[model samples]
Target: MTDFYTVRVHHRQKGTDYTLKVPDNRYILQTAENQGADLPFACRNGACTSCAVRILSGEVHQPEAMGLSPDLRQQGYALLCVSYARSDLEVETQDEDEVYELQFGRYFGKGKVRFGLPLDED
Candidate 1:
């Protein structure tokens, strides 16, 4: 038997709300999209932060969410593309840029660019 959970989503930027009955095994974002919910997403394989959300309540299992760090996931951040609800859920969509910065901001502006190909001198 498939267990379904009530998933409530608050889209911060769009000022919209979506309430969906999502199966425990289904990906929340995909299910929402199928039901005509306008959720943000890019790289549906969980390689990007476009579909990130902050878990306001409930629990989710996101073993395949490679875009987020363990610490971030522990802190209630989830990539919706690969997350499955473990309980009735309430989540707020995140700003892509903001989440991206939080995930990888440490690497930005820390590297020096090398111009052209370097030739080794003997």
Candidate 2:
């Protein structure tokens, strides 16, 4: 049988509860997305620590943290993009700051962006 991990998310803002089931090698952020839940995330390859958070409980493995700083990792901080839940876990989102608010969307529903400023041509 395939192994799966369960996670319970306690939203700090909406006061909502979300439960998710993820495969053993899958990241928590993917699991949240699968359940139609939105957690903050960027640079989904761990090249940036933009998706870093505190692991309130459970175990996780980070293969490529792209210099998150050992001090931060020792303090229970984790980069959700490259981290996989070793067991049932709880994590804090980094979107509560006034400067960087997190708004997530379904992976399939992501909008496209066109580079460069608009130019007049007719």
Which stretches of model 2 miss by more than 4 angstroms? 95-122
On TM-score, the candidate that comes out on top is: 1
Candidate 2 accuracy as TM-score: 0.67
Model 2 Cα lDDT, one tens digit per residue, 1-122? 55788777766666776778877777777767878987766678875566677778988888786435454567777777788888888876545531122212221134421231111122
In candidate 2, list every pair of residues with a backbone clash: none
Worst 10 residues of 2 by lDDT: 98-107
Go through the candidates in order and give the C-alpha RMSD of each one to the true structure.
Answer: 7.3, 11.6
Best by lDDT: 1
lDDT of 1 by residue, 1-122 (tens): 78999999999999999999999989999999998999999899887789999999999999998777676788899999999989999999987577777755655465521231112222
lDDT of 1: 0.85
Clashes of each: 0, 0
